[model samples]
Target: MIITLTLNPSVDISTTIDHLVPEQKLRCAAARYDPGGGGINVSRAIHRLGGKSRAVFPVGGATGSLLEQLVAEQQIDFQTVPMAGWTRQSFVVTETSTRQQFRFGLPGPAWSMDERELFLNTVLTFPKPIDYVVISGSFPPGLPADYCAVIARIVRQRGARLILDTSGEPLRMAVQEGAFLLKPNLGELASLVGVDKLELDEVEEAARSVIQRGWCEVVVLSLGPAGALLVAKTGHADQRIERFRVPAPTVKKQSTVGAGDSMVGGMIYALSQGKSYEEMLRFGVACGTAATMNPGTELFHKDDVERLLNWINQSGKKVFLPVADGIN
Candidate 1:
């Protein structure tokens, strides 16, 4: 089973206003509420693509209760660890005239040391044999800097592959622990490799460095509209490392929210299906680009992903070795 962890979940409130004039008592359309968090959204997208994943996160207070209700409405299976603080909410306001979107996020409640232990224990004690464990989103306050590393060890002990999608120090620490794969954008990748920034020509070399160091088995570099680059060591000892670039499909733009998480979800779903790495990356780019065609935090539609995947395959994208038809 695929399991996702969102350390800090949220109740996302999005609305649109005709205009924004300073302190003018601006009015907005009726607010729309959706569950918001990296891994949570990944689970949501996976479900959208006809897959099942259990979402595990900490919840507290009335807002937490509402968050659970919202997720339940989406029919995603979940387990919540009790917490001492209320779950936070985020605001997304769009200016209809200019199509400008503004997002405001609130810090989550700090967890005490004891509370943090319980949280980790909850994940460690997951009953089933987890095939994939996805840990994404920001580290909640009061959590240790190496929290992802701790989680990496737990999942490793269970013999489950880990998919890490996080940023900053936690990401750097987690990479050292190693994982099945990582999806880091340009900026996050630069930081992990100790660079101020990376030029276009430096991406492949930088990504190759990460894999060469054995930090992770797979590194998927997300290049936004340009596409993604996949670099990895060969499974056979004598075989060489390989790289593939899946170009992004051009589409009308909307809100970019949830696109990255959707991309991660798509790749994970493809992996679960025993598809090739090229297929996984192709489907991932398809999902991400599709997500950008819609407004708000809404993810991609399955139909859109299917069409884009067809386009990618038709455009002669690079291929990777296929997985066994029956690996179960």
Candidate 2:
């Protein structure tokens, strides 16, 4: 079974407006709400792809109450720990004229050490033997930077694969702790290696560096519209690393929200289905690209993923999976 952990969950609300003039009261269309958080979104995506994953997160306040209702509406299985602070809320306003979107996110309420312990115990005692443990999203205030790292260790002890899709110090710490897989954007990858910037051509080397250091066994460097680069640690330690780049299929664009999470969800679903790493990236990129065709935080549809994946497979480039010759 696949399990997802979302520490800082939220209720994402979005609406579109015609025009804005100096803070005037702007009339907008009806709003839409969805369960918002990295892991929650991933679970939702997984469900849409005809897969199953249990979403684990904290709950507090009336917002948390509503979040539960939304998750149930999506028919996702979930478990929650009581939190002291209210859950956060995110607002997105789209400018119909320019097609610009402004997202306002509130920092979630802080949690106490006892609360953290309870959540950790909950994970350690998951109902089933976990096949894959996905830890995504940000750590709420007061949670230690090593939050994901702790879960990484636990997942490893259980001999389950851990896929981390997060950023900043928490991501770095989890990498240090060693995860089975990672899905980091270009910017997040640069930060993991202590670089201020990276050229498109340098993405492969940077990703391999992470694998060689034992931080992760595989790295899926998401390049947004350019698609993703998959780096796997295979064969002898002295051999060159295996890598593949899948370009995203072109499509009508709507909102960019939830694309990355959708990709991670897709990849996870593919992995569970025993697909190759190359095909994993292809299907993942398809889901992410499909998500861009919808407004607000809506994820991709299975039909869209299938159509895009077919195009990507037919037009795949002659990219070789080179074995890693170690980090140096």
Candidate number with greatest lDDT: 2
Write one digit per residue (lDDT tens) for candidate 1, span 63-172. Answer: 99999999999999999999989999989888899999999999988998888899889987997788999998987886888988999989988999999999999999
Q: lDDT of each model, Cα atoms only? A: 0.88, 0.89
lDDT of 1 at 20: 84
Over 41-160, each residue of candidate 2 has an lDDT whose tens digit, in order, gives: 999999999999999999999999999999999999999999878999999888999999898999999988899899999988986678999998987987889888898998898888
Steric clash pairs (candidate 2): 239-324, 239-325, 240-323, 240-324, 240-325, 241-322, 241-323, 241-324
Residue 65 of model 1 has an lDDT of 98
TM-score, candidate 2, is: 0.95
